[model samples]
Target: NTQVNLGGGEGLAFRNIELGTGLTEFESPEVISLLDASQFRLLNLDEKTSILLTGGAGSGKTTVAIHRICKLCFNKHVLPQDILILVPHHGLVLLSRKILNSIGLDQIKVMTSREWFRNQSLRLLKGIGKEVCQDTPFRVSLLKRHRNMMKVINAYLDTKKLEIVERLKRSAFDDKKIVQFMKETAIIKWMKEIMKGDLSVVQKMLLEQLVEELNDYNAIREEIFKDRKLLKNIMDDQSELITSNVIEETIKHTHKQFLEEFQEEDSREHTLDQKNISFRTPDDVSGTIDLEDYPIMLIISNALNGGTINNGETLKKYRHIVIDEAQEISPMEMMVFGHIIDQERGSFTVAGDLAQKVDPISGFTSWEDALVDLNLSQDLTELKTLEIAYRSPQKIIDLAHHVLGPLAPKRIPISKKHHGGVLRTIGEHEAHILILINERLEKLMEQEPKSSTVIICSSLDSARRYREGLRNLANVRLVEEANFTFKPGVDITTLEQVKGLEFDYVIIPDLDFRNYPVNDYSRRRLHLAMTRAIYQLWILSPSAFSPLIPNE
Candidate 1:
């Protein structure tokens, strides 16, 4: 429809190619050539070094990004390894890799940003000659509390000059389980005092065992001490020492320590011993390190500044980075990526739609805020809004816009004609809804036998329920975070799991108020679900529908 001149005196013509019926059943092979003049401009971008591409679902943002990578690798003579395509979730990696492989750019790295950041950070931390311990918030809190409680207990024993205390200390140090049990008991005591509620079955069992071991008269009748009376006195003293005040003080100290260690902007290293960071009774030590993404970024930043990571050569080379699903990237991640990317060369491209941002905790709220966080000048960075969606049908896009109400922008009309698409709702009894869903799937299979399908639910439990209910169907699998099977067959998964993915047919069960209420998040999620369907969409409910949906 239009001709665009590349900077090198070459011209490329764009034409209308209908996503016509009669494509290969396995994949949408036309995606590589689906870019229009507006989308294709990214491949020949020379006016600006950086670009921020904004578009709704199926707007060809990702397809254009992939093509741009090919352009750089093949046309511009860029190394495949130099290009980084950062997808939001792992589910998108499979398709991206496949696309890259199809075009002979298979060596290019396609990974999640977090995965890349984590690997680089760990390498940098090791290069700095500093021991690093990765830990979870829950385990960190528990470990620190236990450690501080033991400190208090040791200090209490130091003050006691009694011979019984000496024997207890020797016995405790000889048996590590005794000390570990004492540490667990501190957490149990704190829980009982703070919650003031009935303990869980596991906690109650722990408490009951602890009390029986330390407080029971017959429990400490062992022959470890020459005098049973002295051992008994030591047990009674230990019980008294682990009082409410000690537990509270230890917990308070743990909180303060965590705040100082984790919240400090200039924190270099943590004091926790990496060798012994386990709380379970059976394992004395665990080499498990599960650091958060933000903290890893912070460590990488610090390491780079200090000149320790890969001898400061890990990120020294300029990288052409493409960040997909940029809306969900946190400010810190954006900042770190900004620092890592070559600003002058303008080799960075980020594509995302804000309306589909489901991650509230770390997701950016606006493009302005996101740019500010990325440390980029608004005037310099070229902003491209892809108005025409090439993935989903216009009818599906219209339904998505309707669900989003005033928050969504009106889709720009496409001149090329296509099917109106199918949007149907089935309700009433659960049995009836199931029957209707099966019938619809049967009809859809008869029409397009190899069309990809997904049954998205509100929650994981709901997805499991639907997958079980629709078990009679062939090639159906329940998709979760661990097992992400984005295959050709039917996949039943949660809405969050299916982000940045498309299906020929999408079935959303239980479109009721309880699951999808009339809120900003719920409405946006519903919009995202509707837009994922390329040809047809089905909404199933049980005699009740979300008010977010229109009566029509």
Candidate 2:
């Protein structure tokens, strides 16, 4: 028993709660005595079944998941190479690979969802890539084949439309064509940007029309105007009809859609040549997949491909799959995972904490909904949840929940007393924060020179700008999508980019309210940023982050 100060000058008595009924310790790192019985049971789940392991920030769900891999590799004699460990970001891949390697389970395939799909799509089509840059050319091939279309793309675009409509008003450009193009720009996005497809029958007609015109612009314009009835029917729903004589001026962004769809039925000569694939533009409805999000389209394309490469030198269908950071994947992506697992009809494991989900793009709502979406509810033996945090300091977890506010679920803290964190408001006019950071960083480094630390920013651009003054420090690097190398020094990074990473000390600077508002996404992101600190945390802001969770 211990005496606790109640902060209001009251004293209360309490005692530490032990984990399980027995005090015996197990020899394996995974089987430590302190581990909650629930976590141990999760590690020993049936190898032939799928699993979903969820927990709060420091609940050791990751630790349990890694242990399960060890169990599969050694106890079940599963080959390391056969295990497909899919993760949300590259950092997680690096971290998972290290943990797996420590258990002598080398050659496990660690990949982002994109890399996995790319390998899958490549094996199905033997080098039949888009001479046109594929957003994976397999995607272009899929589009031309009419297997992946409106339904999947529309679902993906609709979410984006919701986000964009909230951020932007209807555009003010005067030209009707420009307005139409802008509307389409926000809808279908740039499919033409990466797609190099074989010409459709209509594009051939447009090409011939362009070739035969003697007076160049005027002649082509006249020919197009002459066929207003036919062209109008072709572009019936579009606001901009082909009436303008200034063809070049009018055809700017909208022409690609028009030309891609405009092919003659008789002109499109089909041949037995296996390589010659013809592409036709479907009359686009409200939306289609944006090139910016390639994975969404791949989900649709893979669905079209029916879970296997139908052709030569195909990659083996993975019977054992493991997905990490499951909360970061959207509902549609859950469908993709469902399709793969169902096709192989094999068991897999997925682990994540809903509280730590910070990705704005993620469509996860609740654990029940996630299971239903993935069609795993009935098959799931039980939903195992880890409540005790083994990593985060109590102070940090308390702060995280405070930020999450009244609705967030409570978590048990297993760590001893936490101290050495600083949450201060550094006014814009106050002494240069950079100098203070530089001095503090030097002190931390001198004590633990080999330890890792990171200076957290709200965005990559902010991190890029903030790191300019910190370059004088040793091994201080900026973590971005293209450049991420975690070393024994400070790293400048943003919330989303730094997922599945930890540092001995974490510094969160530049906490401007404009950048981080009192919103769900922002709070979740801040919560994640807070939990990254394995030891100490420092919150340096221009002002208080949110009124709900003051740092005092």
Candidate 3:
């Protein structure tokens, strides 16, 4: 069960309704507190609820989600590991992880969509236990364990003194008799025998003693190789001596052959086991199988249907599941999660700001649209809205509202002092605007050297052009969205990449309609770019694009 606190100034108490019944009543608050306190306390534990939080920039949606998660973990007595928080990208996951860490709940793991899928696949494989082999992708119960075991074996073989000595002797040299003698040595034969078998306690003890003797011989050989003059003299003969180039080529070919043999043996061993192996897609039938095609929904369903782990216990112990930046996730991805929720009987909490979505290029739009498309709303019984602006000032918010128009939701009013700074737009003439912007930036730097600023463009070409134009300005750095770092200097970025970030000053160049035509997605992205300015905003564009702005 999840509880939400919609804090503003006014209080409205609303009751939770059943599936058929709508929101019953909007009762007036008995106690009208100055700070609006709206609480959503879940009464039922069995019921699974899906929540959609929609708001523009400055809204306290993120804060509410964080608080909600913390409340569930500490107050509700939910285990930290059970609460899985999903974010859009790796960056947001890190940011959320930092936030959670700061709040003393460091155990909460944040995973991106790709990471989550990988983890789920690993977990499902692990449930099958040692009945499955560790060679093939489908057969391997755990990828890390399989890889680690192979690595250990490889390391052991590579470090074996007898093997190393044999390899060195096998290299072309005048002393063919010495090489043959080394290959037939008793020590080399014993080492091979022990390495081939699953050694017991007694066998391992005997091998350790043999390894010690081998190390001593290895040290002696290494000391001999250390004498550069002796080595040069030994290989001095033109026809009798083996050149270093020939030795290197022989070793490379031998290593490649050895690797091929090892892989073939592994494949043979893996196929010997008669396990019920199946593939999700036909494409994964050959080569390295990608288990990602095995839908998460199916895995979760099987797990819930009395699938036991190695310990013979049912694998259904998670308390809660969280999906952050849910707006960017596709309907198929959400369905995978929805199945997990139904199977595990765990609570689901998805946090995302719909207006901040910018992944349309990859086919994901908004959570609202995704839900409708996926038919996930059939289970969703409650809807909540978080409307608080904690990051920006009122003046900045006002400007954002004016520029964003219909897209900007009503945010909590901030003080005039909190507005921080004003936006100054110079004329759109390239050279003149550049001079004015540079002058203003220089003056601001003089006043506040520590203050940071961002110069944004809608396209990479324009960003490059602006960066090239500003190369003459000393200490004025041009940073692209790809190369964005938290440095106390001027940064130039694009609108798409600058979402979910705030800057002290934002200089928007090439904001003309001709350059960036207004569309539903573009307008939302534009709002995101405009609202990022915490202190100041400078929008430079042609007079033709001026009509887009509301005529005051």
Candidate 4:
């Protein structure tokens, strides 16, 4: 244990030997102690049963889950390959993989829900005589869209669309040909920009027709010119020049390249007929199959509808399924998976806390509602709640509970075994706020270099601003979903991005009314951010604090 003091004699302890850089790394598998009788019992659950585990931050939910996997593998002799752990994001997937490998259960598979769904759908498709392309040409297209040149092209096309739309509105040309010309020009310009003026007749026609069907552009919206407002919004949006055209052209290029390679191999095979070279032609490539998110869901939904996955023949590989961060799983997704799971003898373990739900559009009311959506209410062998937080200090949990206000009052009292955490608040002018934060951070780093800290913000924009302001500092990074490295450093991220993650120290800068308003969602977000800190939490602001903060 290492002790550190943040100014004014406020001290905290961090067990870095046990925590090891972060939650993903553990020094030993024996870290799962038997002191928590509830956790011990949970690890020894019946082999063929399902469970729903609920807990708040630092409640050792994930610890228990990992230990349960170990117990199944070592104690019950369950094959490591027969278990699948589904996490919400790529970061958690990496974390789960590390924890499993640390315990010598590396054969267990860990995947994001999207990946699991796509792989399962493709497997089922192959079972029914459908040829699936293993190569993802769409990834190249996606990469191109995020490049700087694509932004410049999009800006240019947006300018042209606005000018053309304005001129069309002023003129009396009400013919459909004018609309077609405008759409044709946009597609031609986009292709020219992409291909550097090298265009083909077939490619041009395909792009023009396909641009209308692309979900992002929906060129059909501008077809009839129902209202000028709609046309203007569509033109300004400029979804046409953004990503849809790149995807279509890349797929075509990939198919063309494959055919050329095949013909070259065929020519070689003709000279040596002794060698058996049975091959499928590129013409067999299915246009209906795409690995993109929406298409993956569409294929899975089709399979579910056609009874391809209803029999659970393709899903018999895994006897146990563990889904962490279950709160983020939407009802529709859960419903689909529930239907498939019910068909097999595989048991599932889902663990999440409803209080940390930040997505308002998911319509995830409660666990009861989710079980009903999954059609697994009767098979829910246990509804276990882990209310004791073994790692977090009581002061932090108390403040987090205060942020929940009435909601906290209704739930069972969530207590922490550890005591004496630090909660510090500092108010300064907008101009000098960053300076104060820097001073405090420098002092904390000087005291404890290995302590991991995260500066939680209200939004991505806020996180970027803080990251830029503190760019000169050492080991400070802006965490994004694509590049979330949970290393020992000062991470700046939003509350949503930092969900299902914890840190040794969490700093909430600019905790004012503008950033965190007084509302239920905002309250939950603040609570979620507050609970991410295991040792200490700090709230800083330039003006009066948000009403959600208790005036203690």
Candidate number of the best lDDT? 4
Q: Write the per-residue lDDT of candidate 2 for residues 1-552, one digit (tens) a residue.
A: 011111110000000111111111212122245577777787777776678778777566666667777787778556676678888787777666666666577688888875665455444432222122223233222222121222434443344445434333332223543344345532222222212445555543433432232113222222332332323222223213222332233233223323444444445556777343456334321112222233443453343233332332324555567878887765655665666553434567878877777754354556676676566755654577777765556777788777777546765444533533434546452136677777767776776566677788877877887688787888788878624554566778888776766666677777667777878877888888888766566777665455645746
Measured with C-alpha atoms, the lDDT of residue 76 in candidate 1 is: 58
Candidate 4 runs further than 4 Å off: 1-31, 118-317, 339-344, 377-380, 409-414
Whichever of 1 and 4 has more TM-score, that candidate is: 1
Backbone clashes, each candidate: 2, 7, 3, 0
List model 4 lDDT by residue over 197-303, tens digit each: 34455544544443333222112112211222222232224244434444445445444433434433335343255674546555444322333322223223333
Report lDDT (Cα) of residue 451, candidate 2. 60
- In order of lDDT, best first, we have 4, 1, 2, 3
| Deviation in Å, model 3, residue 190 alpha carbon | 47
Ranking according to TM-score, highest score first: 1, 2, 4, 3
Q: What lDDT would each prediction earn against the true structure? A: 0.57, 0.55, 0.48, 0.59
Model 3 weakest 10-residue run by lDDT: 12-21
lDDT by residue for model 1 (207-230), tens: 445333332211111111122222
Compare the candidates by TM-score and give the number of the best one: 1
Model 4, CA-based lDDT: 0.59
Which pairs of residues collide in candidate 2? 134-137, 201-263, 201-264, 202-262, 202-263, 202-264, 203-262
